[model samples]
Target: MSINYPKSIENLIKQFSSLPSVGRKTAERYVFHLLKQKPEQIKLFAKYLHDLPNNFKTCSKCLSLSEENPCSICSDKNRNDKIICIISNFQDLLAIESTKKYNGKYFILGGLINPIENIGPDKLNIKLLVKEINSKLKTLPEIEIILALSPTMEGETTSLYLQKILKNPKIKLSKLAQGLSTGMSLEYVDENTLANALKFRGIIK
Candidate 1:
């Protein structure tokens, strides 16, 4: 069914629809909303889009997206350096931060293990994480690693692999429990649920 939209409108719809989980109808709605915006607002939006890549840089330590190297969280001296939270992405880190229950460092895995996608243990930043942990051990006697990943099959797989590689008597590995529903990403969980999960995190053994 052709909507008979003009070339520019159709192109905008196509671009919006290309985004994750965005359907054609949603894309059309987005395009219409954009069309309703003032020219100044539209230009500002386009400027932000154009400047995004250059403005944001991935943190060297945790791999989280930030404007500065080491990122604010990593560089913050007040945060507990002995406890490191391993997360799947920057969004998950933000979700946890919103709770204010966890005052620790973070290590972003970048992505989860998916055999179909050919994303194995080597594909992630596991090596860098291990290096960071080992380097930190010299200053700190003991450290806690929190596996703050989603409860999906890929999350489990990645967690298990991390457990095997990071097993150490001096290090304690734990994961968020109870309040988190199964198969839900941390990024989308409610603040209350996330807070409870952090409060009652379970030891991985």
Candidate 2:
């Protein structure tokens, strides 16, 4: 009735299983695969994983992960400061950026509003977003807010909450066009489809 694997190997498997979408079987496979690799390589990988959290910081403006305080996109002079694309996560932001059609800046919400999961506006960085908008209004004077969140229920709830908080006539608020079907995530949309959606965004009431 004794397990063949060492205690350390079992512990590593447990740790890997803790990751999102990784089950015990996959974790075991991963551990065995890593065991096959050279100690130096494993050491390097471990070092990188251990240092990642300390190495990267979130941008003050957009909350994107970055080595710098403000990410490259936030500091880019070529990007349009007049418009800000609001996305649920960094993956959504990357999806929009891949289209190469959107020239505006981005505000990453980190996640959507999932009431069932107890995630709400306060849990998100909404206050920082409002502060960013206020700062922009004072400096730029003319800016638009674009909601590029997913078409899911959570996404809609988050968008509505953000719209309510950022409701100012001075800021032109818009949402991505209906091209993106309901219940679909932006990350899965093709580049051309995403580009067209961006090109034809509509004002949100």
lDDT of 2 by residue, 107-196 (tens): 998888999999978888888898899989998767899999888899889888888888787889998888788899889988998898
Q: What is the per-residue lDDT of model 1 for residues 100-135, given as tens digits with 9 covering 90 to 100?
A: 899999999999999999999899999999999999
TM-score of each: 0.90, 0.92
Looking at model 2, residue 27 earns an lDDT score of 100
Model 1 TM: 0.90
Quote the positional error of residue 54 for candidate 1 in Å: 1.7
Best by lDDT: 1
Clashing pairs in 2: none
After superposing candidate 1 on the true structure, give the runs of residues whose Cα lies further than 4 Å from its correct spot.
1-7
Q: What is the lDDT of residue 9 in candidate 2?
A: 96
Whole-model Cα lDDT of every candidate shown, in order: 0.93, 0.90
